[model samples]
Target: MAAPVCLEYRIEGNDFMVAGAASNNIKNTLKMLGISSSVCTRVAIIAYEAEINLVIHGGGGVLKAEITEDRVKLTAEDEGPGIADIEKAMTEGFSTATEYAREMGFGAGMGLPNIKKNSDEFNIESEVGKGTRLYSTVFFNKQ
Candidate 1:
């Protein structure tokens, strides 16, 4: 595609039923545009994890995907109780997910790690009371 394509979704906190919708939509968009399967899978994982983070931790937020010829950028922004320690939050198996969320099989503490793993570039900024924002990029040509 010559022009960039942008997709955005509003994710609600504790909304289990609609948690995966935004990620799926982003993946489908990549596929429809003939993006490579590997890239699509990576982007899908990033999007899904970010979406879940929004629902389980962010107290609702916005998830966005920007597709360009060379890369896809994903952003998850939330005005929820933000992370106090980004480093700890990024640790695998460390989570603040509610008991209800755990019962629903939603929180395993892998969200940030997984997103980072699949992203060509990843960044996160959060404030204790303000909110959190995550940026992840997946390159289309990375083999």
Candidate 2:
């Protein structure tokens, strides 16, 4: 395990073109840091999903990464019309994205599930009129 490293990224709302930039940068950083390939892959997937969610559902947000000896933590905070129904939003095929988002091939309603699947731990909080925040962690296994 290496020393703890912290990374942060700002996600622009409705920016489809740069939606995955933060995740890509994080992936590359992990690779350069010599993290395990499997770990990096999982992180990349979760990060990408979370990033897209920020762009699609968040209106705009920020992503924070904290790397420790045992795990990597990623948190995304966005300021958008909060999710009206958390339960419905979690459904596989449920989506409230605008036509433009859908046209961009995003908002398939799989982002949250995918992030949860790839992370060791996941938590989400949202306020109807405020915004949403997601916290995810991927633990590093001692081989």
Candidate 3:
């Protein structure tokens, strides 16, 4: 088995110009590592979605990716004004994105759902004034 690898990135709030940089970098790294295409695809989708969410809703946050021979784990943690209703936030087409966010071609409100859909396991925890943390994992074998 290969040794585990961890990659981290900071997502700056209100940054539309550079959003998805982390996810794209991770995807490229996974590809260079020769991870299976299916697994890479899943991870890319989830990572991109989560990264964009952080940019739009997270105030500011970190994106972490831990990769092992058998799994890839993704975690996104943000500070301030966390989700008031996670359930509602998870619903498709329900977005809190601003007018500028829409102009950026985002705010379709599919980020969380897509993240969940692409993850083999997923969990989310949040507090209104504290923060939100999303944990998700995809098993290599699941592909």
Candidate 4:
């Protein structure tokens, strides 16, 4: 069995240029670790969507990836304005992205929904003035 692997990324506010950087890194790492390509693709999508949320909504945050023999776990912690309504935020096509973010072809309100769709486990917590933290896991064994 291989030792567990972990990776961290710092996401900047409104940084569209590097929004997908962390996700790309994780994808490459998974490839190097011999994770199945199908699993890698799912993780990539989950990581990218979460990273974008941190960039467009969270102001700034840290994204972490933990890889083990059984599963891959992802967490996003941000220091921006937290989500006001968890239920509302989860709804598709509901976004509070800035005009600039919209101009970047992001902020389509698909980030969180996509994240939830791809992860085997998903949880999110947010405080209006504090911050938001997201937890998601993708298992290597499908059945």
Candidate 5:
């Protein structure tokens, strides 16, 4: 095994069309590096969900991915209005998305839950006016 590989990407707010680009890139990179298909799929799914959340919920954000020999770490940081009730937000049907977002078929409130489900570990922190940050880790063995 070698030292972990680090990758970083910037996600733009309200840019729905480009939302999944980062995750796609990460998937491709991992594939090129000969990562297992299962691990790559997990990473792609969670990363895509996180990226879309940044576009729809976050004003804009940065995504950092650290690929270690045994696991992958994903962190998303944004400057948008933070979640008011994280517990409720974590629920399946709770959402603060706008009508536009809803019309676009997003903001179904499944982003967080899906992220949590796909990751081995998940953590989220937010301030009403400041911003939000989410962290998730997926173990290769588990994949």
Candidate 6:
């Protein structure tokens, strides 16, 4: 594609029923664009994890995907209380998810790690009281 294609979605906190909608839509869009299955899967995982983060910890936020000829960039931004320690948050088993979220089978402390695993490049920034922003890129031809 010569011009980039962008998809954006507003996610609501604690909205379990629609939590995966944005990620599923992003995946389907990539598939329809003839992207490879592997790339699509990676992007889907990144998007899904990010989406869940928005719902469980973000208190509502925006999820965006920018598609280009060579890569897909996914971003999740939220205005909720941000992480005090990014390093700890990135650990596989560390989570700030509430008891309700765990009971609902949503939070397993693997969201950020999974997103990073499937992304070719990933970065996250946050302030304790301000918010969080996540940026991830998946190259179309990368394994």
All-Cα superposition RMSD per candidate? 1.5, 1.4, 1.6, 1.7, 1.8, 1.7
Q: Which regions of candidate 3 deviate over 4 angstroms?
A: none
Clash pairs, candidate 3, are none
lDDT of 3 by residue, 1-143 (tens): 45788999999988888998999999998888888999899999999999998888887799999998889999999995898999999999999899999998999988899999999999999999999999999998622
**Candidate number with the higher lDDT (1 or 3):** 1
Estimate TM-scores for all models: 0.97, 0.94, 0.95, 0.95, 0.93, 0.96
Structure candidate 1, residue pairs in collision: none
Query: Which candidate leads the pack in TM-score?
Result: 1
Clashes of 1: 0
lDDT of 3: 0.91
Q: What is the lDDT of residue 136 in candidate 1?
A: 98
Q: Compared with the true structure, what per-residue lDDT tens digits does model 2 show for residues 51-72?
A: 8888887888999998887789
Model 5 bad stretches (over 4 Å): none
TM-score of 1: 0.97
User: In candidate 1, what are the lDDT values of residues 1-143, reduced to their tens digit?
Assistant: 78899999999998998889999999999999999999999999999999999999999999999998899999999999999999999999999999999999977989899999999999999998999999999886632
Ranking by lDDT: 6, 1, 3, 4, 5, 2
Worst 10 residues of 3 by lDDT: 134-143
Model 4, residue 113: distance off in Å is 1.0
Per-residue lDDT tens digits for candidate 4, residues 6-120, read 9999899888887799989999999988889999999999999998888888897999999988899999999788988999999999988888888889878878888999999
| Model 6, runs deviating above 4 Å | none
List residue ranges in candidate 1 displaced over 4 A. none
TM-score of 4: 0.95
lDDT of 5 by residue, 12-34 (tens): 99997887999999999888878
